[model samples]
Target chain A: MKSTLDSKNLPILLPVLAFSLVLMIWELMVRVGCWSTDVFPEPLRVIISMGELISDGTLFKHVISSLFRVTIGFYLAIALGIPLGMLLGRREIVKHLFNPVIQFLRPISPLAWIPLSMLWFGIGDKPAVFLIFLSSFFPLVVSTTAAVISINPVFFQVAANFNFNRLEVITKIIIPAILPSIFTALRISLGIAWLVVVAAEMIAVKSGLGYLILDSRNALRMDYVIDGMIVIGAIGLFIDFFMKRLGRIDSVFWASATR
Target chain B: MGHIVIENLRKEYSNRRHFSRSPGSNPAEYREIIRVLDDINLEFEDGEMVSILGPSGCGKSTLLRIIAGFDKATSGSIRIDQKEVKGPSPNHIFVFQHSALLPWMTVRQNVGLGLRNIEDKARMEEKIKEYIEMVELGGFEHHYPYQLSGGMQRRAELARAIAANPDVLFMDEPFTGLDFLTHMRSREETVNVHEYIGKTILFVTHDIDDALIMGDRIVVLGGKPSRVKMERTLHFPRPRDFEKYPELGKLRSEVFLMLGVPYAV
Candidate 1:
């Protein structure tokens, strides 16, 4: 009876317990150390700051802007990456020609492109979106290529035996075969895109959670900085949850379930 | 004419050894040409279920694949209905040893994939339903390949191959990896389907019992670079009971002996 009760309530109870324990420790540290609210604002102060930001519409504006940049950048990455990856995956000669360049670009950080993005697209939404796109594209391409390459050769043989044309093979077999792995890649690349957007906003653009954090920090509003961080973390978690649901759809059920 | 003719078929693979002779050093060696199928000649009349019986790695599957046009012979030619077999065609389908049912597709979809070119939606749907029911997967029509058991997966593949209405069906150990009961049931189902539709079947198997049970004619293959060792025609009628027939038991022993499995008299 006790074990069943524990199992039933644990999901909700544990997180709440852990959160309260952290808050208690934080309050204790502040009391013991006599730290100033300017250096480290307490949880209540952060909550109040969050309320002020929400009431004034600052939080929503920043969040919407960040979301918009990520959306545009991510879709662009998907559009360019998947087809190119499929082409390179199928053609050995093309892969061999471009593989080294892809590898070289893959390792370079998205932050490394910020200066160039600023020079090309200027200090606005364009530069931030460009950085997010660059950040997401490489991982997307690499994963899509791997997914295509790893598809069972038997599928192709079966396709051939059925006398499928090139278009039929691509649409029916290749696309479905690569979808599960590509969805996993989508999750990872979107997370990276989100991370890059924040960094890009901090430097390249003027309005996002990252900009809020930097702006609040410069003005010595530690509560607003902490609030910005909480918002960033919450949004990231939500995006990941959404992607997970997308991967669970019936068409790619076999691939995701195996993993 | 659905007759198949395989003439002097040969397949040689060059096995190049790439091993390290010294620590962390790559070593190069001369390539060795290994003949998997050496000068194989076989013929199958229309509507005949011929079993290519052999030991593992005896090129039985290789020959079946060559005829299906999934693989090319190094020399010689395969002809079906007086036409040269150059590539895979919808007229013939090969059922792989491992179930090749597309994991993403439901049983119905997998079975109907080959029939996508059929213009009549009602006709296509009817064929799909018919094959699914024939394979005893009617209720599980919407289940994915992974959701089914090993036996069901094999049945789904069989349904897929048969639904195509091929002139020839090349099956490479289609019933391997099933439980004993499931194996027997599936074998009976295979025979029933053959009787109903009457497609020419070229089945490859190492099991003497499978050969005896399913084949109208058993072609035994042996030797290092495999060739047809012997051919025997079973005169028994459909659904032959080997347990009741002493003649079949004697033939089974003879086939085992030909496969190099000695039996004490």
Candidate 2:
């Protein structure tokens, strides 16, 4: 029971300690009048600012908007990336045709697509979602393709000896053999998707944590900007934790085998 | 009813040219020359356990692979049960020297790999249980191959091979790396399984003791073309002892002579 309390106390404890340190330094500086509010706000003012954002519901709206964009883009990436990876993995001809194109596009930053995205789809959420998809797509596709092709040849021969047709060979043997690697790709892509969504929202017409940070900066609300950064960090951490849990469930056999 | 026939089998691996070396006066002489297996002819009968005993690079494993329908002969015909062998058969399975159990899968799943289409999950489970019991790996069914010891892994492979109920089981030096005592136990279990099912086995090994213990008849093969040097049939009854049959040592010397190896000191 004490251990459980210790574990539960961790989340509140570290932040509280860090907050206390920051507040002590800020209050000391403020008492000495070394810095003005415009330059560096006190910790108490930041807390009050956080409370105001929560009550106004603007913060909640931006958080939900960002979440919705990330979810859709991330799911789309998985849907498209997995099949594309399988194609590249299985067919030499297809891989050859697309290999150069993928190589050319992979290094282009997701943010670089903003201008072209706006020209193609107009502003609002489309550009943001597209940027997220672009960010997640390459890693997911490449990792899965590498995984599928890297499966042991012995397993392939075994499948052939079992009278497995092409479909059966792929579905029953190749997919299962490569599933662990594919799951690893999904986790990586999810992180990339979250990162890209924030970057996209900062530039292409806005309503997200990124926009809130920018807006607060323009309004001389440094406390609100800090709050937005905190929210982004907290959300990203939560999603990562959930992703790890989901990965464990999806790759139970793989996890146990590796262990 | 699978029978393998190899006639004038030839295999040659081409080597890449070296840019550092200038073209030779006789370019053909400079070409890489390796004739691993040349013009080999053989046949295997149904329900027979034939051991292919030879030194390294004698193409014994290659012959087994061709028989297993994994490799194609350069210019020879291989017929199984009088039908031309085109590719892998559903009723033929090859067991490598190393257990080669899929590391990701548990023993039970490895055993049931060939039976993926069996809609009746219970029946498949029962069959896996039966084979695991046969190899005395009942409690270790859920354990991965890597978790088990080397001997246990071979036993699991044996259970997997038998679970498929293949007509022809091809084993390529299945006990090569095992210690003497572990090798004996695994081979003993393999022999028991063979007795129970009566599947045609084409076993390849370099060990004479293994050939003597497990094979009903042994085919001694030699280097360069890998033709059969001699054939010996054991007339000893069940549970034969090596010490009691010192003749096996004499035979082993003769086989070693044919293989161009000196007899044991």
Q: How well does candidate 2 reproduce the true complex, by DockQ? A: 0.41
Estimated TM-score for each candidate: 0.96, 0.89
- In candidate 2 the C-alpha lDDT for residue A4 amounts to 47
Candidate 1 lDDT over residue span A171-215, tens digit each:
989999999888899999999999988899999777989899899
Docking class of 2: acceptable
Instruction: Assess each model's interface with DockQ, reporting 2 decimals per model.
Output: 0.79, 0.41
User: Quick one: best TM-score, which candidate?
Assistant: 1
Per-structure clash totals for the candidates: 0, 2
True contacts kept of each: 0.86, 0.44
* Residue-level error in angstroms, candidate 1, position A159: 1.0
Q: Could you say which candidate leads in DockQ?
A: 1
> Over all chains combined, what TM-score does candidate 2 have?
0.89
State iRMS for model 2: 2.7
